[model samples]
Target: MQNPAIPPLASEFSDLPATASHGPLRIEYRWVNETAATAPIAVFLHEGLGSIAMWRDWPQTLCERLGMRGLVYSRPGYGLSTPREHDVKWPVDFMTAQARDILPALLDALDIGMQERTRMWVIGHSDGGSIALLYAAQHPDELAGAVAIAPHVFVEDISVESIAQTKQLYETTDLRNKLGRYHADVDSAFYGWNDIWLNPAFRTWSIVGELDTIQQPLLAVQGHDDNYGTMAQIDTIGERVPHAQLVKLDACGHSPHRDAPDALNEAIATFIKSPSKAPTSTPARSPK
Candidate 1:
């Protein structure tokens, strides 16, 4: 497919200094604070093929609605961030790397400590949603709430089939071109994600068990028409996580932020603003 003719927004923030490294990559992020009162911060993690520019005005709108600060950034090899030097496929532990390594480095680089009083809310989509869940599962005390859109907690045949079709589309159709506009090194971002999800080893991947470890409030949203993943993904999340709430949007797709922005925004705002259960004295274990 030919690259879509969408106008690119001007870079919102000039290069803030690069934070610490994660293996071979240096992490970078932009922080937008609408007030100095120190309200909760909503960290926006984009989808596999998404960049800060791709999020357009949604982050700002959400931040304004909640009267909070917003943090938005492209992962390694996406958007204006550093790109990998070689064509490397994402490993089976890609989500682990993101949760345990990249995310902490970025938060530290931006001076957002896990113990900060200002509550942290994560808004992640697709692959980002999985990463967010992993992080919340691992560090429940650090986050106030999380909203995941079309998150995949368990591998499904349908997801792999859809990804295979996407690969074919990228090769034969205008998909790659459209993706190129968002990613500086489109192939790196595209293949890094596409290859990992389609890999045979990834088929057995399931983080549903880990959801039980997450004590923070969670909201999982899925569109009925999502071409890439089924509602079973979020259903599994809710089943394992006691505080998880699931919302299904009719006629919505993988990208609910784009397909059903109004519903998505409302769902997220409510999730974040709602009162959370009292923290437990002991951390929970992963479900069997």
Candidate 2:
């Protein structure tokens, strides 16, 4: 069964010109709750391995709950977006590049001018979550608020270990094949994320210093039992951004939207309507 009031998610593509550093990018983005009257835009950025399809109906449901229009998009090399070359490697600053370059460019190509951006909100998960933090730091004036779920502001041993296990699964199991369902080039997406994270040089990666520059209200969520990152991620966010709200969830893991959608939804809605730069009425779970 489905609710008629919920707007069905639909996707569109745009061909963006090449940058001096990278080649052309064809971005795939979807609209959530399109039937609703004009409202704030909630932009969703997916996990490293995630794509537009990986989000399923969560974006639509979240947008419906908040009476906002949603925009969920796959970064280059994910979903139906342009794929990365098989031999090329992602730089350590890949996530930074996305927040600093790709996001702004994508919005520009979509005709979402600078003025329209001020009212928009960004909700990002995992790697996307990190990018959201960077985006806020990069474009502080353009966003109303941001939600970062299970975001990694720095490298950790647990993250490296978990990613190593996933890489092994990709080699020895059907993980690659399964990922193929969501990524046009699963290798491109997976390897791009994996190789960079596992790189020894990335061990010192940290966004904590950069977080202090973000001027918008932020909601950072994390699961107590997450294997990929610890509470330090979101906690540090609040420490850096004085107005940032921290939500720590119980009986949850890396993905909050999947593990506790109702609670996460309520918490987010409460934060958005709270009318102040303060703590959330409730807490958080996982986001996928």
Candidate 3:
């Protein structure tokens, strides 16, 4: 559950006009610690099947730990935002469109100008992580830094197999019912992400070349037990951006925020304070 105590800074619909390839969108977003007038902003990007609500209290917790403000939102097809058309299939470059177009427009609509952007940090998970990296690459000067957790730079067989299994679970189990709590149109969110990953064309997708242009601080994190990807994801990131800090959590999985919040928080806090230095992983806490 989202922390009810943290007040909404800007939680309204931002109307996005229809483009050549896609329909109009109304993005839903909220802010954390908005009263921190002098603090840098940390934007939280959700995973493939994620939303503002799905983030629970993690954003607030992280923002408080880092002494920064935060922005959390659902992408167009998830949460309270507009749903994808029933007949439409997302393009192969859908993530690219999200990074280059949707995010910029949302920030503009929210009145986050170049000055605010200069101090902004993007922290994302899974698909959102990939988007964060792409955003940092495209607008390196606009952001202070980025943290990508369980991000995929290229397609992996494990990713496909896991996603395919998820699709089956969504169909055969109560997974859709569970996900329905987070998304207004659960099918839209599920299939949009599911169909794309299973698409054969996406197999050739790789974004390593784009990392060459990123100038801001970057931290790529992965878990040893992640089912969706391997250490090669962050390892490849290290290969591209030698200065990027890498963290591999012991006893953690794809979603570190959930699987190992204490360790993730400590690493992020250390990295934000010292970009050039590598973060020392905290000992994993016992599960509740």
Task: Please report the candidate that would top lDDT against the real structure.
Answer: 3
Let me know the TM-score candidate 1 reaches against the reference structure.
Answer: 0.86
**Model 1: worst 10 consecutive residues (lDDT sum):** 279-288
TM-score for each of the candidates: 0.86, 0.93, 0.93
Please provide, for model 3 over 31-131, each residue's C-alpha lDDT reduced to its tens digit, 9 standing for 90 to 100.
88878978999999899999888899999999999999999998988887898877888988888899999998889888898998999999999999999
What is the lDDT, from 0 to 100, of the residue 91 in candidate 3? Answer: 87
Global CA lDDT of candidate 2, please?
0.86
Better of 1 and 3 by lDDT: 3
Candidate 2 all-Cα RMSD = 4.8
| Candidate 2, 88-110: lDDT as tens digits | 99888889999988999989998
Error of 2 at 113 (Å): 1.7
After TM-score superposition, the amount by which residue 186's alpha carbon in candidate 2 deviates from its true location, in angstroms, is 1.0
Q: How do the candidates rank by lDDT, highest first?
A: 3, 2, 1
Candidate 1 lDDT at 199 equals 85
